[model samples]
Target: MSIRRRYADCRDGQIHLREAGDPANPTICFFHQTASSGVMFEKVMARLDDRYHCISLDSPGFGQSYQPGEIPDMRFVADRLMEAIDDLGISTFHACGHHTGGCAAVEMPRAYPDRLESLTLIGPVLVNEEEKAEYRKTFVRPFEAEASGEFLMTAWKYLELIGAASSVDLHCREMADHLTARDTMPMAFSAVWNQDVEGAFRSVDIPLHIMCSKDDVLWPLFERAGEMRPDAKQSIVGGSDFQPDRDPEGVAKALGEFIEGLA
Candidate 1:
């Protein structure tokens, strides 16, 4: 199936989306990590389009989406996304979020439980205040452009340190997405830092699925998530931070099975 890129209007502005599969099929929405866009799930969407209608969104202030005048919290982000989803005429759908997107995804069921059938958190950051503080110190540094183009190497090094720069092609794609959101990246990270991530994780009223890649930096967090909610389903795939990019088939197989099992 071919992926169609489009926009959905909301109060804040247009939210960009990349969609695949038939609209008549069960919908599964994807929200990507910070400094990235819906393209992160492009390959995974292709693999699952046959079984599910896949819609991956570019969060407000990221990708081709309109940035709000001010930094918005996770709840605000969630509401705006629901508004866009409403514009698509979707009443209920499964929510799958990665990293920072998981912060917003967890808020969806809390505010609009009826609209979300299930929640899937991939490489979720279920950290405590202390851990958050540490992350805030290390992970949210600004990626400013320098006249010498020195910042480009800085960004590349960071991605490489986090195991996201596996291939030159993949790194280039990530850099493109990263640069698109560079100006507003800190705001999104601030939202995540201030969010009650664990509280939102606990408040999920619908079915829950916690997933991660064994090679991801957040793999340890996946284990912590299981400890928090032993009842929620869990799975791990092969790949580093960019699981959908590096291991699309594995990501698709795991996600497809989890969603189908709920049926």
Candidate 2:
């Protein structure tokens, strides 16, 4: 399948997207994790092929996209997505998000319940206020430049730990994104970190699928969310948190089946 690079001006900011499949088919939009861009879903979109009209949005300040004048939250990011899809003349579609992108998927459905046919979230970040506070402390904020290039090594180390699926290409992609990031990584992290994740997802009435790698750090959140929404399907794919890139076929198969079931 041919993946096309595209862009659109939204209310919040400009968004760059990678899209594939037939336009006539039901669209399945993707959202990437914090500090990461739509490229994370490239393999998944490729695997889906002509089965669905798949597109992955580069969140404001990530990838080739431009950030808003001010800081953006997950809800604001979700709104930006709505604007983009509206401009494309798409009325309704499914949404799939990984990590921070999963936060967007949850918020979008809550903000506009009727707009989504279904939702698929991979390694969602859904934690209470206390947990959020703890997560913030784990990070060395600002990620400023250092003379010793420790920041560069830090990025490499972080990506390596999270992307233990042993995919050198995946680690390289994430590392390159981190190195080129424009301080928006922290903003994106705060968006997901400080989000009212529980409340946003608890009210979702649409068909939902929560998939996570068994070895993922967010496995607990995925498990809890599944329990919270017993009606939702849960799939445990083998890999690390970067399962979408490491095992795109599994992710695509699960996502494809979920979207197909909605028909």
Candidate 3:
């Protein structure tokens, strides 16, 4: 099926999106990880092309979207995301998010529960102050200094190691062209640092799913998500990282099945 590329202008900046499937069907808005964009959902969207209306958005400062003069807070990002959905004339929809996007998803559902049908969080960020500090010390801080060429190169090599050459090359080139070490790195760091996962999750009461790779670096955060939403179902995908672009088919299969069961 053909995918439509669209753009929405929000208070922060222009947000790019990729859409597919039937609009008449229930919509599933996908939010991707930091440093990644809607393109990461290419495989998943293709698999779900016949089912739900799938819309993947490029958050401000990512992909083809324009960055704001100053990065907005998570609540602000969530508001703009809802605005994008409003622009599409979608009233109620499901949401799936990964990493940083997952954090935004939690905030969105909390602030506008009426707009969401359900939520699926994949490798969401850790919310508790203790867990957040640990994540920053172990994962975010170490990479802070080497987050330039080396970081991108490492990501490219990891994808290559997993035999995801096409995704790696395309996504890497996109990140290199649009993202900069000077701006995005600090912005991403601040966003995560300033995130309030506990408060956000506490405010949400919708059906929720938390999924992550068993060996993912963000597994700890996913665990925290499970703890935060004890009522939500959880799943594990093997042999993948935060994005899991290489295993999109598996991700789509699991998500589609879960969504189907929900219906």
- Residue range with the least summed lDDT across 10 consecutive positions in model 1: 137-146
Collision pairs in model 1: none
TM-score between candidate 2 and the true structure: 0.95
**lDDT of candidate 3 over 1-263, digit per residue (tens):** 78999897776667789999999998999998766678878878888889889999987777777766656577766777778888888899989988778878888876886888888888877666766666566444333336356865665554454334545475565445334333554466567778877777767788888899876767877887787778887888754553446677778888888888886
Q: Residue 180 of model 3: what lDDT?
A: 39
Local accuracy of candidate 2 as per-residue lDDT tens digits, 121-201: 899777888888888876526466789988887777777777642877777888777765647777777777778888888
Name the best candidate (by lDDT).
1
**Candidate with best TM-score:** 1
Q: In model 1, state the lDDT of residue 94.
A: 92
Comparing 1 and 3 on lDDT, the stronger one:
1
- How big is the positional error of residue 67 in model 1, measured in Å on the Cα after superposition? 2.1
What do the candidate models score in CA lDDT, each in turn? 0.87, 0.82, 0.74
